[model samples]
Target: MKPVSSECAVGIDIGAGSGAKMGLFTREGNLLGESLLPIERYGRSPVVMVGELAGALRDLVKGSGSPPLIGAGVAMPGFACSDGTVRCNNLPFLDHVPFVPMMEQAFGLSVCVVNDADAGGLAEWSHARTELLYWVFGGGWGGAWISADGQVRYPAVDWDGDDDTLHYSNEPGYAIPLSRERMGVELASLGGSWEGFERICMAEREWPGGRLAGPNGRLDCVRAELFVSGNGRWRIFRTLAAADGYDLARLTPEERQALETPSNAGRVIDRLAEQGCPVVRRTDLMFGRALAAAAEFHFRSGPRGNCPDGIAIYVGGKPSRALPWFGPEAESVMRARRLHASLKLSWFSERNLNANLAGAAVLAWNRLKGS
Candidate 1:
């Protein structure tokens, strides 16, 4: 832990992993230091986790030297309320916990808690004055809207603490479930889980179809076409997965076992991808379509009205890191809806990876400045 270059604020991102990510960012937006601490080592006890995180943070700050930590912000996987309660379904141990007070007491500094996706949005808003919509496609879908004034405007009014999901009702809907059901057989062969499907998506550069036995003794083959959201909950676009002539019946024992459970599916999918499955491309294309559908719905019936002036769209999270195919598909959907506004798809990288942390740092700094 080298000494940081200047005065900085601390930002933390807590997710489903064994630890939480923390970063030190300057008011100028430079990330001076970053670390991942094993807070989960404290187990499912929220109070214990908070205490451990505080101790670890104290050590990190002390090791950094000189420049004082003026304020701190936390990006947790939950819905943060004005009353300081956090409703985290993924981390159910933290349900109804008073996060801000807990952190503020432990760190002896002002602390603000926000949803991880909102933090990402704030990170984007910090750099640009343009209105934007940011989506995080990771463990579960979540998003935020950034205004021209550089504020992350979340749909707080619609948040139900007991809903048990990270996302709010105002953002784009989750698409993986529908995608799985639509591409059932392809996913089944690949192992029937997102991990397996995502492996194929990343491995193949092209999509090829296969002809397999259909119901009623019909031999149907279809190319992979994604289902898009229409006017309401119904799929706006429909297509067939025309079978290309290929053999899919040969499955290794490992593949069979992988298909037996959701957890094993990813490993199987990875193996299939390594063996060069062509259908991976189709799943990738479908993901792009999902992004498109989400954006369309956001503007059409979002908490905010249509952005006639258009909005920049920032896609973040684990999936966005692996796939760079959301821009075109999202724009295509916007066009199909006859709503043309500038839709920019931001890729995942260092430029945006620490958005939540950066956003949190900015918020903390603002609090210090009494702004």
Candidate 2:
């Protein structure tokens, strides 16, 4: 019999901000290469954005010396259905657009679409030798999970008792209600939105004295410009804390100094822990978000009685002291270790490559094997 041609697949991960990444992999799960492309969307015009992105991806493949393209898997933010219609929250441009057919026409390849967080979970599971895996998106606190056999088993439309209501796990917007009624007001006053918090964190890092550039003494500047710009809240906070005392008008000199001090942040984290809440550093929060997603996945998928052996993979930057409010790395390690021991599972972090690509490779390999 003639040998069957090896299948090659590509995984495309689309973020809420129209950021795009593509991963190329062989049927055996070996990664060939990956690239990031920009997708410009104009208000609910996902069709246009996907078309533009498909063209760019085609160009990337062509530029890469013509690697054979078999199929493509896409990870997109928003509500996606089995029929391929996507109702994107962050990128309204894709609202109810038929992305699968459009991509098929543009690239002439079979395409599978999955939720972005689900894709991250699948990728992490595929790369590691674990029976359970979780993927978390920190910016909006979105999460998803996969089982040992590569099946997504949590946060499904009908999984929990709530059949009528759709659940978007890990989306802070959908988080368990906070008891403090003024918490929202406090969050807003601090910056206005979660994104606002991230911005103050980032500006505090990128541009010292940047806080003074906005209303509320640079609060609006960080909110309007930096935080909303992308996912760099931790960096922003670090920068601001390190800057001269004048940058933080919100806090008195003594308070600012106290915040900048390592011991203070540790105490804050300890207080949160004392309350039975996990006080993750912004950096570790990013890491734990991913881990939590994996844990949730396992809890929902494995036998109801016990947890399974699994792994959590995180893709991001190394934690730094710039984000003092996030607490210390030692705290993160200790917490993670305790969680793993208690849950009887394993967790791992990889900051090098995007997790979506790793997921696409797995999907492609599975399809190639007819599994």
Candidate 3:
């Protein structure tokens, strides 16, 4: 362990299943030390979770020679508020839990909290120092937008859980509605059906906010995530392959096993795309089109030139790694629509750093600098 100075910060990225990832970073955003406290260690109780996290953080700082902490920033999931209370459906134990104040008290340092997506966006800003859109595709699509001046724009702060209350800029996946009619046409072009895709989605969790709404409030659309995230991408591959009469039964045992597993399907689809599989190519193309629509809605809602032409939309999460396949089509469609937002792989990811932890470090650095 090296002796760090006062220009150090602690970042806490709390995830579902009571997992907490803590990192020690220099003011320059370099990760100095890192540790994880999994659910198996802390269980599901919020009190125990915080207590376990506090000890882990203390050890993280102490192991680094206990440098004078600049501050601590938490990248949280769900509707996290400034008062330390959070309404996280994934980590239901966090319901109304005063995480901010508790961590501050536990750590004896200034603390700040933000939504994990916003933290990822902030991490992008930390590296690029430019206005950017940050989208992470996983089970759901989470995103954020940072201004040219490093201010987070339209953050999902203290969301009241109202469908209309969510802005496309912040909650792009959930707020942006992909026109059902347009999607149906696209699916038909590939010999697929809207009903089939919807069936795949409904077989799992029901759509949040109920039936989607389109232009003029008409219920003729679907949530953008249903066609954008990892699961959605997997769904696209399955539905398209099934429609094109590509029988999975013909695949090797390993291939079928990979695609059949929901958690591993997106990677399998990406692998198939890499092999130049027509069905996989078409699947990503469909996803690219969906992204184009969401990007248009996202850029238009923000201030002028915030996402200027050629500015990269820095992305994170596992699915973002496949941007090389789907990105060109997305950028192409966006350009055809006169939108110039370019999609790029996450900067932090390329360096093998967790975006959430990096972003939390950036948040703490910002808080320290602002003071």
Instruction: Give TM-scores for every candidate, taking all chains together and pairing residue i with residue i.
Output: 0.69, 0.57, 0.92
Model 2, span 248-342: residue lDDT tens: 45445665565553334433333333444322233334323333333343334323313343344233212222223232332353355444422
C-alpha lDDT score of every prediction, in listed order = 0.56, 0.48, 0.80
lDDT digits (tens) for residues 17-119 of candidate 3:
4488999888777777899998788777877777888889888878877787788888977877766688788778778888778877777888888889999
Rank by lDDT, highest first: 3, 1, 2
Tell how far residue 204 is off in model 3, in angstroms: 3.0
Q: Which 10-residue span in candidate 3 carries the lowest summed lDDT?
A: 207-216
Of the candidates shown, which would achieve the greatest TM-score relative to the real structure? Answer: 3
Model 1, poorest ten-residue lDDT window?
A: 231-240
For candidate 1, write residues 127-170 as lDDT tens digits. 66568877665434567777777666644432553322323322
- Candidate 1 vs candidate 3: which has greater lDDT? 3
Off by over 4 Å in 1: 1-5, 155-158, 161-170, 174-278, 302-309, 341-352
Highest lDDT model number: 3
